[model samples]
Target: MKFDAILDPDSSPHEVCELGLLAESYGLNAVWTSNYPSSRDPFINLCPLALASSRIRLGPLVVTPYEMHPYKIAKALASLNELCGGRANILTGGPTGVNATMGMDFSRMVGRTRECVEILKRANPDEALNYEGNIYQVRGYKPTWATDEPPFIYIGANKKQMTHMATGIADGLMLGDTTERRLGSSLRLIEDNLATHGRSRDDLAVSCLIAWHVKEDKKLSSSEAKRHLALRGMLDIWFLETFLDAEECKIVDANRANIFTAYKQKTDVIEGVPDAIVDKLVENLSMSGDYDDIDGHIETLKRYRDMGLDEVAFKLHEDQAAAISVIGERILPAFQSH
Candidate 1:
């Protein structure tokens, strides 16, 4: 399996360039930029990195069709792909709740995402795209300057309906915060969907977003993981059920406000929930702990590979450069040889 790094969007373009070069030198596969509402434009953020790196794949994560039309997304993505020599990627999905606060409509998400992918697939400079969909449409729209090979388009899907939609249309599927217990079922759904669509497993690349919070100090590492616990699938009941029992799930659900408070406050002290439950979520949902924990996470990654992941994108939290070095020097060697 290939290992990729998903950088925090706060990094300046120059910083991203430096890190992209670092990751490339270490034999990492790709470098992805997270698409946060308040951050720099993810596509533009990769320009410096794209111009500097030779081999690492680069692109924005989870661009929704509601905020930006697929035509506009394709234009930017195609330009980025040219800068990277055709190694760019784009993962499109429905409008996120965080983005929804900006007044984006969240209804008909599956249809919007599906139509976005459909429009993107045909967004080629070779021909003027004249197509119609329930949510999006393009009438004789073509970018003659976008002549490079189209970048990889992945659907940010983690559920059954979206997975089935992606298997039929997208180049790949990006499963967010998916755990070991749930991965097998997700992949099975993908396989069955692909077979129904008459496509092979090789036709689509599969990747997962895993939180990486390891630090030199174990205490700091665990604390950071706890502070960010609310992000693991937004502490959804589906993911919580993988490890937490029904009662535990209810407790987590009830104290979600406290969890979010801690996350927003950037503190480790969750007021209403027990430390044990928080630790359990961190353990099951993320790869955390100190330097000594690297070996175990390596084994976890290997299991993901064995279960059929084409790539695993680690979402680095703090000291991203140091994390990249650790992953490059330690975790990458284990899988690169294969």
Candidate 2:
């Protein structure tokens, strides 16, 4: 499977560009920055990387149509693609944290996402695009200067309805926080949807977003992983069920405040939850531990590769350069022949 590096939105444009250059030197496929309301504009942030890098694809991750119109998305994406010489990529969908912060409408998210993807897929510089969809309408819009190859358009989908929608239309499906135990079901769902749409596995690409917390120090790695653990699937019961028991899942659910509080406080202290349970969650949900644990992580990644993943994007937290080096030196070599 191919590997991609995902950066936090807090990273500045220059920092992201430097990191993208580093990733390119390491032979990584792509570099993506998180899209959040409070962070730098993702599309603008990637421009520097797009200009500076030659081989590595660059773009923003999970930009919902609710926050911006499909036409505008195409405009920015096309501009970025031109700068990258056609290596720009994007993941679009709905129900992001932006929806909560902006109080945007969430109804009919599936249809809206479909329209956005359709608009992006139909974007062409050679011809004017005039589309009329249930949720979006574009008239006399033409990106005449965007003559480079079209940017890869991915749907940020994980659930059944969204995954099914992606299989039929999107260039790729970007699943977030999907673990090994649940990956089979997710893949099956995509396969079933592709068959129903009269499409094959080769028609679509599949990738998952995994949290990366490995550090030089095992204790520091575990601490960072715990501090950010609350973001892993939001400690959802469905994800916890893969490792935790019924009562333990209940405890986690009941202590949601503690988990989120720990994250907010920038510490690893998750009060009211057992240490064993927390460890289990960390082991099952994220890739953590010191350098010694990388070989084992490589094994887990190999299992994912064998399971038919086309790509896996590692979400880096702290010391991104170190994590990128580990992935480049230790991880990339393992999948070179695959």
Candidate 3:
């Protein structure tokens, strides 16, 4: 499995670009940024990365349809691709959490996202794309110049309907919440959808996003895991409940309820979480542990490869440079040997 880095929007552009350059130097595949409403604009922030890194591909891991029109996405992507000599990828998603956070409507996000992808494809190759849809309309829109090739367009999806639509229309599929069992089921869903379209599994690249925190100290690892889960759990409750199973959804909802209840009761459930509880939470929600002495991380990644994931992007939560170094010094070499 190939490794990539995800830049948090809270990070500064200079920090993101520096990490991108370091990732490139470490021989990683790409650097993707989040497009959450509160975050910095990914395309704009990526300019320094485009100028600084020669090889690492840059793009949003997934931009929401409600946040920007396809025309703008196409324009930004085209410009970035040209500037980077054709090393940009565009990953998009139907608006959910982002829209909710930004107070944008999510009702027409799926239809809008489809139209956006079509517009992007047409806008590439310097062709005027005339599009009219329920949510957006574009007439005779084309970029001034085109790159050698259009950026790869991936769709972020987690539910059955979204998976089917993505497999039918997208260049690739991006999945998150990457536990081994979840990865297996997600790949199966993608394969099943592709088969329905009379397409082979090889026709699409499956990218899994794993929330990762690396540390040698068990206590620190546990704390990091708790912090990650608290944030992700809140987001999932707000946006991803539809993608989860009944039991999983219950857990998320119950957790959210508990957190809110604690808030109302003038207490802090999140702060009071102990190390043991954090360890359990990490095991349930994230792919993290000590990756220094043994090949545990490598073996876990190989399991992802075995499950038919084409790529695995580690969404590092801390210390980007050190994370890259660990991946370069330990994880990448292990994968290459295999």
Report clash pairs, candidate 2: none
lDDT of 2 by residue, 205-285 (tens): 999989999999999999999998888877778778877889999999999999999988998999999999889989989
lDDT of 3 by residue, 1-338 (tens): 67888876687889888889999988999899877657788888888888878888888757766777778888888888887788888889776457778777667556777887877777745567788777778888756678556788888877778888889878888887655666677789999999999889888888877777777665566556555564443445323433545555555555665544543453334644344443555665566667563377677778788878888777776666877888888888877854
**What is the lDDT of every predicted structure here?**
0.88, 0.90, 0.74
Which residue segments of model 2 deviate by more than 4 Å? none
Q: Residues 1-338, candidate 1, lDDT per residue (tens digit)?
A: 88889998688898889999999999888888888878788999999999888888888887888788887887788889989888999889877754665885678888988888888888887899998888688899788887777799889888888888999999979898988988999999999999999999999999999999999999999998999888889887888898999999999999999998998899999987887888899899999999999999999888889999888889988899999999999998898778
A best-first ranking of the candidates according to their lDDT comes to 2, 1, 3
RMSD of 3: 3.8
Q: Which ten residues in a row are the worst by lDDT in model 3? A: 233-242
lDDT of 2 at 332: 98
Q: Could you give me the TM-score of model 2 versus the true structure?
A: 0.98
* Candidate 1 regions with alpha-carbon error over 4 angstroms: none
Per-model TM-score, in order, reads 0.98, 0.98, 0.87
Task: Give per-candidate clash totals.
Answer: 0, 0, 0
Model 2 / residue 99 / CA error / Å? 1.4
> Cα lDDT for residue 230, model 3?
46
